[model samples]
Target: MEKFTTLTGVAAPLPIVNVDTDMIIPKQFLKTIKRTGLGTSLFYEQRYHEDGSENPDFVLNQPAYRDAKILVAGDNFGCGSSREHAPWALKDFGITCVISTSFADIFYNNCFKNGILPIIVSAEELEKLLDDASRGANATLTVDLERQEIKGPDGGTIRFDIDPFRKHCLINGLDDIGLTMQKAEAIAGFEGRMGEARPWV
Candidate 1:
């Protein structure tokens, strides 16, 4: 996991709602547990045709959004299965932040665990962000986690809220394992004490 403090990059507009995990990476791409290579397979079905050619009509296939780091999507984003690979694919694809009106609970948590910031804003605010993203190559938005604000292209700012613990973890690049490791010394001490107390076992 990487620390997510502030990110300023092109925002890709994905107005379609109910984007599920399968649509993100597809089941065929889930054979490998490794995260790095999944980026190319992100949104595989919609991004490619049956003959393996790129779909020019897809938003991600467009040249301007090919390297987008932020996604401004419609409501109910990440609404299906609770696969961790979904966030892995998004992060691998260089999407550091996702802004939407609403997101599925499991997918939202998975995003944070994988170092991706999933932001929820009002419908009105999302429309504005989508408008900014419509500018194609010029759709650049700045996401400042510490300030909990998103700065749009024209300098307008939208505020968002996040849980304090999740915010701290992202700032410090701490995942679940990282959180547990924070008490390494105590864990070691406990093991040592247990061994001394129960030598026969």
Candidate 2:
């Protein structure tokens, strides 16, 4: 996982509520365990038509939002199955941060694990961010993890709260595997001692 200290980029407005995992990457794209390549398929159904042509109406397919690094979505985002692939798809698509009024518990946890920042804000705050995101190519927003603040295009700021431990993990680029590696020396020492004691067996 990459370290996430601060990020400033265009934000895409996705005002639809109750976005689920299937709606994100779709079941057809779930066979691969690898995280890469899913970005093109992110929101596959909404981003493509029946003939596999690009859908011009989807927010992600629009000219201004094609490269958006942040997403400002409606309430109840990520509200279905506990698929970790959802966050993987989002991160693969260059969206490292997601701001919404509410999110499903499992999806929210998955975001942090995958180096994606999932922010929860008041309904009023979401409206403001959405308004900023509606500005086409000028929808830039800066997310500073250290300060727990979100700076909008017009120089407005919104403060958010996150668990200290999660913040530490993201700042250091420590995933579950990375966390285990931190104890490698101790683990090796214990293994050596066990090997000596079991030599007779």
Candidate 3:
């Protein structure tokens, strides 16, 4: 996982509600456990037509938003399923953060685990951000994790709250495995002691 301190990048706006995990990557793309290539398949159904051609009308298909690293979406985003692949797809697609009025619990937590910041703000604030994202590639927004604020294009700032522990984890780039590895010496010592005490048992 990568460290997330402060990010300023283009934001893609997707105002559709109830954007479930399935819609994010689609189940067909889940066969691969690897993370890198999933970006191409992110939002496969909506982004591409049945002929596998790009849907020019899609926000991501637009030239300006093609490289967007931030996403401003509608309420109940990431609503269905608990697949971690959803976040993998989002991160792979260059989205470092997702801002919405609300998010599904499992998907929200999964985003943190995958190094993607999922932000929750008021509907009023989200509308403003969404409007900013309408600018396409020019919709660059600044996210300050330390101060918990999001700066919009119009010089407006919105404050958000996050769990201190999660904030610490993201800042330090520590995942579950990374957290456990922090006690590597202790774990090794415990194994050594156990082996010595229970030899031949």
**Highest lDDT: which candidate?**
2
Per-residue lDDT tens digits for candidate 2, residues 16-79, read 9999989988888889999898999999999999999999999999999999999999899998
> What is the Å distance of residue 59 in model 1 from its true position?
1.1
Candidate 1 off by > 4 Å: none
- Each model's C-alpha lDDT? 0.94, 0.95, 0.93
Ranked candidates, highest TM-score first: 1, 2, 3
lDDT of 1 by residue, 87-174 (tens): 9999999998999999999999999999999999999999999999999999999999999999998999999999999999999999
Per-model root-mean-square deviation over C-alphas: 0.8, 1.0, 0.9
**Tens-digit lDDT track for model 3 on 88-161?**
99998899999999999999999888999999999999989989999976798999999999998888899999
Model 1 earns a TM-score of: 0.98
Query: What's the lDDT for residue 63 in model 3?
Result: 94
Clashing pairs in 3: none
Whose lDDT is higher: candidate 1's or candidate 3's? 1
Q: TM-scores across all candidates?
A: 0.98, 0.98, 0.97
Alpha-carbon runs more than 4 Å astray in model 3: none
